[model samples]
Target: MRLNNSKKAKFFYFLSSLILMTLFLGAAFFVLEQYRFYILGWKSVLLIIIPALLALIFIFSGRQIFEYDSDGEALNFRNRNVLTFFNKPVRDEFPKYKLLQYEFVNILIFKRLYITISSKKNNLIILKYDVSYLTGKELKDLKFSLSKVIKANQEREKNS
Candidate 1:
């Protein structure tokens, strides 16, 4: 199974752009009005501050685009932010047998995936991914795929 949330990411970018534009335009208009009327009241400040805060919340709540590929004997995962300059993209790949456990977490606007895997040095490594942009169906599919791999790994371990 291969899954990527490119469509959702595009929509997110569009919405964020609209909000940011609105914020900028509001601030510009407020400044112009203040200059014309010489008014420095709380109401005018509130008008600008509210939208700025909302835009900040909307943008900060946003998550990176996530991609998953479970082909051949390895599972590959990738996470890249919309603003590429902020941080480097994360990529991970490991064989099925190395998978130990997987979990999903949902808290308000934040959704995340946690995966535990065995390293070559026999140490356990935990990885986290933002899944806020994934749809319900996509999340379900991801859970099913990870569960299948975990089950298979458990069976193989028992047999061994």
Candidate 2:
């Protein structure tokens, strides 16, 4: 199940990004116009370029990547950004023997269903759990779906 933050969260992101974009781009334009007035010479180019580029990147990085297996056997996700070029994608294969744990986390104005897996392994949470935003119904459905798959995996593990 692909979940996303509420509309309010998205709107907040948009408004903030829009303001930053306007401010940075406007300043960049003003600085570029004052090319000859620069005492710092090449340093002026870096100053104008950095914030303008950051603003553009800020807008782009808001995009999220989500991928779940058809059978709910695995999930992978990541943020769409320049860092993604270096960062490996987060992937979790619903492990058979590991016990799953979950809770409701309240961060600022948001409520989220947080889940983690426990096992003999040293990893605290075997899956790189990105906070996927889900509505009440979606959360319920995810819980149900996970329970089913986990049970099936456990049975298979037991048989083996």
lDDT of 2 by residue, 84-153 (tens): 4434545455543454555655454334445566756657663333333444675576567667656766
The positional error of residue 124 in candidate 2, measured at the CA in angstroms, is 4.7
lDDT (Cα, tens digit) per residue for candidate 1, span 1-160: 9999866767767777787788888898788768786576556776588789877666555456899999889999998777665467789998999999988888887788999999989999999888887889999999999999999988999999
How close is every model to the real structure, measured as TM-score?
A: 0.86, 0.43
Q: Return the lDDT, model 1, position 72.
A: 88
- The global C-alpha lDDT for each of the candidates, from Candidate 1 onward, is 0.83, 0.51
Question: Which residue pairs collide in model 2, if any?
Answer: none
State which candidate has the highest lDDT: 1
